[model samples]
Target chain A: MKGLLPRLIKRILGGIVMILVVASFTFFLIHLIPGNPVEAKLMQLETAGVTPLRAQIEVQAMYGFLPHQPLDIQYIHYIWQILHLNLGQSITYAGVSVTHLLLEAMPWTVITVTSGIIVSFVVGILTGVIIAVYRDRGISNALTLFSTFLHGIPQLILALLLAFLFTTIWPIFPFGSPYDAVLTPGFTLPFIGSLIWHAVLPVAAYAISSYGGWALTMKSSVISVLGDDFILASELRGLKPRIRIGYIARNAILPLFTTLTLSIGFMFGGSVFIEEIFDYRGLGYMLITAVGNLDYPLMAGSFLIITVAVIVANIIADFVYTAIDPRIRT
Target chain B: MSAKLTDRSQQDFGLSPEVACQVRDLNVTYRVDGRELSALREVSLDIRQGQITAVIGESGSGKSTLALALMNAVSSPGRIASGRVTYRGLGEVTGMRGEELRRIRGKAISMVFQASQNSMNPLTRIGAQLLDLARSHDLPNPRAVLREAGDLASRMSLDADRVLTSYQHQLSGGMRQRVGIIFGLVLKPEILLMDEPTTALDVLSQSSVLEIVRSIQRERQLTTVLITHDMGVVAELADRVVVLYAGRVVEEASTAELLRHPRHPYTRSLIQAIPRLTGDPGDAKALEGQPPSLASVPNQGCVFRERCPYRMDVCETILPSFRFDGDGEHRFACHYEEARHD
Candidate 1:
């Protein structure tokens, strides 16, 4: 128990360090983008015919958009404000708090991406096992070829293809947003049904796009694990096929868990093309808008949330994996 | 249960032969890089009931292949090309399939692999692994299986609860080996196949494990097929010995007879290579050159001709068939059988 507590503390500290690294990198990268919030707002004002120089000065003062401080100082300030849950107001969506914007979009992104990852993980792992079991057979080869094909097609291309099939060809599911605007926002059947109906294409696109990689990873890892001495011993024991698979998967699934967690982390932030192609108002959609308008506050806020989500997911995976594989417990 | 009862009745009537398993002209071959390599060549041997028969050979000598063949658990690319491995009255294992083969495997015949410690599932707890094995064989009561396993552990002088509950990584190598042996023996198998169980252990642990195995074999009257290269280990535990060279049985005799009067030259060289603690150090002669590769072994001659000191002209063209020494039990595949018996 004493040894375990220290290790647990160390793992959490490692996760925090990872998040800090991600946050710092995103902060610098966002700053490196061409224009500031002041310049963006000034252009918007100028596009409306009157160049409000005084209004730009007030906007700069309010948003801390002026280049009075160095990049590192601004980063430290940004981190400090983030620590206090103050992500500042967005320049892209006027009068909207970046924190508020994130909170609103977070549910949609989390629901779709989290669901996609879970579905993909389950399906991929099962298919991987089937592939491994029948590795020498034609079916295994055909499935492997198909998965490789799926993995090769770019995410944007996959989303567009899926959108075309579901929206244009079949016209079975809605594609514009998370739900129909006519549906009342409540815990009612119609609202939930419409939400799912609208989420189908986007979620399917994300799930199908990533499932192949997981399947291939699992198949290869399981194949290697099948050669392990323990697996051979299990065969000698004349264990039933299901029991044998259970033992094989127990060992084979450890390395895959690391990738599974990483996918969960990446999916939360990297579903940019999926959201845009679907016209879904998720965090990925907001991030695209923030990047387009140079909304540093909004971009940093969304990136920080994603960084935290990924790090936390990985840390949880570490804990769960250690618990499952006794070799790793120590 | 019916099989166990029948075995007990046969022993009671004194009709059950001593032979626990019979191997007739068994040939195991491995296909590597589109070439068929003979791993075991027409290897015929018997595992006597209630005795330790050690198949002593160096690496790639097909000793492990013989062990796998006995269980009919030989993996793909390596197969039992010809001949039969009969598990006494259980029928031909080579011809058996599915449940028929599986029933005899873990229940009647169990094996302890080389470096058997690595053969344990690291992800599983020791107790769970034991329970799973026991339950797979249709041991109805989990508690009874645990109790029986605990009894076996204590009999082996291991801490029953501690060894059972701990994971594979948590145990020492010796403990792991002991667990593996216990796993092999837990179902009360009539025949046990141990493939270098003590080769990787320290001297103390090695001797202790061997001692425990010997005692267990004696108490249970278990037939054990021990595969090892260590002559000292063979001398210590084996009742009878079969010496293999390039996947062929070079010699077979009672351990005492073979050690005293080794008929085959390869067997003689192997015995000479053992460094005696009290004997003259000058007597320790290491065999020259590498052990023959399966792919390159000449099909029509003595496999040991390249290394044999007394290689005759006939040894190159004709493979020496087994020539028996008076009693017929002691046999050697060498043309110069009567040249020297001392």
Candidate 2:
């Protein structure tokens, strides 16, 4: 325990440094965008037929972008507001705290993405195992072809297609939005069910696109491992077919575990386009809204969350490697 | 435990009272690129209880095919086309599956192949793999079984705990082969098929493994069918030798009799091919040419006719019937058996 303390401290410090670096990078990149919050607000007021000069002055004071302010002073003020966790008030959503708005929408995003990943992995692995065991059979060939077709379609296109088929044409599912407004402002089973129902098209769209790659990877791994001598030896030992399959598949599937972990990390970044297509109030949707309104704090917060998720996922994968393979531990 | 086993031990090293395995007119063919290649042709041999029968042949002579046929594990594009592998002592009591032919496999019979390094699971501890085999066969008291397995490991001159706890990659090739042998023996199968079992081991390891196998065969009364291209192993271990050439058994006799007076020219050439400790002073005689390609082999006549030094018009036209040389158990499939004797 005493020996571990230093390593643990180093890891924590490293993690903090990574978070800060990512946050700063995101802040600077978004800052480099052509328009500012004050300019966008002024443009909005002008479009609303307010006096352009007064509106511009009001927006400048609101954002501390008045004439004669030094760039260094403005940067200091921006950092101070960030340190205090005060994402400036949104121009679009009047009087809404960026942090509160994100927090409210975060759970929906987590539920959809997490559940989608879990479902896809399980389905993909099982299908891959079956395909590998019965390779070259009609079922395997058919599934491979179908999955390839599904994987070839872009996620946004798939989302829209599913929405069209399941929502507009068939009217079987809720087209857009998580909840039906009647049970809003409080958590309820019905509200959650409706949310899940609405999320199905988007989740399926993502799952269908990703499952093919996972299945192909897993099938290839299993095929290669089955060719290994140990699998044949296991058969010679007179192990039952099921037990033999399990042993071979377990060893074969180890590398896939690492890939799965990495995929989880990447899923955070990937969810943006899918979320935008569905117009779901998730982190991706929140980030998009913030970008449109030039809400830097919310954008930075979302970027930070995703970056941290990716790093943590990679660490978890490393730990899992040691856990699964004793050779790695030594 | 049985009178047959005890009586067999009391007698000279010979086939035991009961027959363990019989392969009659066995044929195996492999289809490659729309061509049928006959791997084994009318190869018949018997393994008596508590005896080691060696099938000696060169590469592509169908020795491995015969071994796989016994195990019923010939891979894709290769299959047993004819013949029934009959087991005398092993029956329904072994709990072999119906259609799967698992009846003889692992319970009644088991096999160890040539490549030992590739034969054990690298990820799993040897003990766990052993336990898996034991429990799968419904063996009782797995912990006790595992303990006995450790004891068996020790008998093989391996560290019991180290071998049991170690993964496959941790052990040397010979150690893994010993484990494989022990695994086969632990099941107490009636017949053990060994396809070049010691082919991959070092010379020292080979002799040690052979000794272990001989000892275990004696103690457990296991009938073993060994396939090897090595004449030295055949001379040392086999009670009877079946010489296969072009998938057909050209000669079959008691080891002493066959080595003393090999009738078929193929068998004679095979024995001559073995490097002598005392250098051969006689005419340098070795069989020329590779075994005929199985796919393009002619449908009629003796398969060895093309390569036989004593080839005559009759040899190319007709397949020789297996003829006894007045010794009831000694048989040779050669037209000139009598002529050669003269």
Candidate 3:
């Protein structure tokens, strides 16, 4: 226990340093984008035939967008607002706080992305194990060829193809939106079922696009691990084939865990086009709306969330490595 | 279990055999690009109980192929086409499923291969690996088994704690080979298959490992089949020697008898090639030319006819059969039996 305390403290400090770095970079990048929210709003008002001078005055009062204010003072104010959890109001959502809008959409994005990743991981790894065990066989060769072909195709193209088949030709799955208009957002079985039904096409698109890469990676890992001496030693030691394969797979799959975690973090950024295609009200949709309206606060908030998620996912992967492989614990 | 009972019944039908392992007409073929390349051709030998039987040959002479066939560890593209590898205790069980074969491996018959450094798990500690082996074989009281394993390590003149805790990557080649040998013998297996076990080690380490193996084999009365290309190792450890050339058993005799009077030209050349410690180095006769390729071997004669210095038309036309000398135990597959010399 005594030995563990210092290590735990060091890990906590490390995490804090990582989070701050992510947050600062996110702030700088958002600030670097061309045009501020107040300027865009003033430009919009002028386009609508409002007096330019009056529109400028109103925008200044709304956002404190003084042209002479020092950049450091503006950055200080931004940091203060973030510290207070004041994410500011969404321009497109009429008076909804950016935090509230993001919170409301979080569960839907999580549900689709998490389910897709989990299913793909399990199926892909199993198929890869089969391929590695039966290497050079007709079935393994066929799977390898097909997976390579699928992986070479762009994810967006795959999604569009899936949508064409499922939505246009089959007419089995709902085309867009995450729920029916009649079902309210309460804990009702019918509402949950409607949401799942609407999510099927997009989820399938995500899983199908990702599984080919995962399978290829896993198959290569299994093949390399099979070459390790321990595998042959285990066989010579009279271990059953099932047990031997399982032992090797456990060790071989370690790198995949790290890859999966990092990919999960990046999944938030990847959902933009898919969410738009499905018309889902997730953070990706919010990000698109913010970019369209030049809503700086909402855009900054979504970017910050994504950056933090990626860093945290990496840290989690490190922790998992120590847990699974004792050699890494030190 | 039923098969074991049947083997016991067979033993009861006849008196217990003196030989630990008997290979009768063993043939192994590898299908390379749809062509059957005979790796071992009608090889026959016997490993006596409580003695080391060395199969000495040059590279590509089917020494390792015989080892894999005996162990039933032949992978894809290579298979034991026809043979009876009958164990004295286990009886005749060939072409068994992997699971059934595994039941006999590491228990009744264990093996140590040439690449001992790569034969151990790098991720696992030595103690953990030993415990895994012990548990798999259902050794009683695993903690005690591990303790005994540690004791065994010390008995082999290794640092107990270091060997128990260190991974394979942390140890030297000699240390890993020592651990491998101990790993095989600790199970008290009836037969131990050693495939060029000392070939990868340095001279000092090689003799040390050989000494350890010799002492353990003597103490345990273990039957060992050692495969090597070195005649010196054959002289030191082998009670009986089987010489192979181009996948065929060219000669077989007691180590003393074969080393004294080699009948086949290949055997005679191999013995002559061994550099003497005291004799004039210039006088030693080294065998010239390489062994023939298995893919395009001749259909009608001895495989070694191309390489034999005293080859005749009869040697190229008719394959030689195994003929016993005056002593029935000493056998040679050569047309020129009259050319024998001591």
Candidate 4:
């Protein structure tokens, strides 16, 4: 316990450093691009019939920094503002703060992708073990063929196909937005029910598309594990089929740990195509608009959040994997 | 040590050194790339009651295959084509299935595998794995079972508390092998098949493990089939020795008799290959050729003919059968056994 504490602390601190590096890199990269956010906002002011000089003054006053300011000074000011949790206003959505907008949309993307990943991971690993144990059986053969077919198809295409199938062809699920617009937002059961109801199509798309990869990995892992001497020993001990499978799965699941963590990290960035196809308002949906409009602060803020999520997830994976495998615990 | 076992086996079963398990012309074959490769070619041998029988052979001699065949656990591509593995009081094990096979395997026969590092799940604590085995066989009173495991560990000279709590990787190579041995014997099986148990151990650890095995075999009256390439191990621990060459039993005799007078050329070569402290180093002889691979086994004649120092013209065309002499206690599979013995 004592030794592990120092290692855990080091990992967490390293994760923070990674998040900071990602934030600074994205911030500088977006700013280094030819177009400026202020200039784009100035054009909006000019179209509203404001004089060029006054529009320039308005942009300077609103941003609290001139376009001609030195890059280092702007970076320092940006870092200062970031430390204060003030991500500045969004140039795309007038009068809205990037931080507030990101917070509002964070939950939707988090819930959808996390739930989808969990669903896929659980179902894929279970089915993969089944397929491995029954590799020669007809049913598993059919499943392997289907999963291979699913794995080859791109996720975006799968999402769009599923959306069209469920929303237009079958008319079984709700089409657009995370929830009904008419419903009052609170902690009510109906509101949460409506929210989940609307999220079905997009979540299912993510899960079904991601399931193939996890299942294939698990099948291969289990197949290799089946050849191990411990497995034979377990069988020789007269262990029931279920208990033997449990032992096999426990060992086989180790290699999949890193993959699962990275996928969870990717979830924070969310699935943009799924969000866009279903018109579900989430970080991925916001990211597309931010990119199109070239909202620097908004884009960088969301990227920072996603990068942090991924880094923290990876750290958790390292610790959890070490905990699970005694060979690595030392 | 062996005389006591022999006398007891005769007195108890009254069949004169009663057979614990009999392998009746068990033929195990492997199909590789559409070709049938014979791994064990119509091999028949007996594991005697309350006696240690050492299956001594070089690699690829199908000694390990013989062990797996006894347990009915030949993996994919390998099939027991035709033969019977008869376990006394349990009937035939070759075609046995379901609860009958399970029951036989559970409390009747257990095997300790080679490569001790891989024989245990590294993620599980040793105690938990032992407990799991107990639970799997529906052994009642879990607490009592675990206590017995600890006692067994202590008997093997392992620290009971530390060994039970630690994972496999936490133990040294020899310790893990001991744990594997203990686990194999936890159910008190009638037949214990130990496949090269001390192959990877240091001299001290090997002797220690050998001592533990000897004591256990005596205490429980176990019918142990010990597989080894080491003639020294065979001499030290086995009561009876069966020499296999290219998937066939070349010689089977009492250990003392075989050590004193090895009939087959291959068996003589194996005995000569063993290094001795008392003998001059230059006296050690290395066998000339590799053991025949399963894929390239000769279609006719004695498999050892290619490397036999005393190869005869008839050895190239005909396979040898077991030739018994003097009360049929010692047998050698060689056409010129009479010439060689005389």
Top candidate, metric DockQ: 1
> What would you estimate as the lDDT of candidate 1?
0.83
Worst 10 residues of 3 chain A by lDDT: A59-68
- How would you encode candidate 4's per-residue C-alpha lDDT over B261-320 as one tens digit per residue? 889989999999988898698789999988889877788988898899888988899888
Model 2: per-residue Cα lDDT at residue A157:
81
In the predicted model 4, the residue pairs found to clash are none
DockQ of 1: 0.64
Candidate 1 vs candidate 4: the DockQ winner is 1
Of the two candidates 3 and 4, the one with more favorable lDDT, higher being better, is: 4
Q: Candidate 4: where is the Cα deviation over 4 Å?
A: A1-5, A39-73, A267-270, B1-17, B339-342
Output candidate 3 Cα RMSD: 4.1
TM-score per model over all chains: 0.90, 0.84, 0.86, 0.91
Q: What clash pairs does model 3 have?
A: none
Candidates, DockQ? 0.64, 0.49, 0.45, 0.58
Off by over 4 Å in 3: A1-67, A76-88, A134-153, A161-198, A227-229, A326-330, B1-16, B122-125, B138-144, B165-167, B272-286, B296-298, B340-342
| Interface RMSD for candidate 3 relative to the native interface | 2.1
Candidate 2 per-residue C-alpha lDDT over B247-324 given as tens digits, one digit per residue, 9 for 90 to 100: 899999989999999999999988887776676746546678878878757678878887888887778778888888
> What lDDT is reached at residue B277 by model 3?
83
After superposition, candidate 2 runs with Cα above 4 Å error: A1-21, A27-101, A184-188, B1-16, B91-100, B276-287, B336-338
Error at A117, model 2, angstroms: 1.7
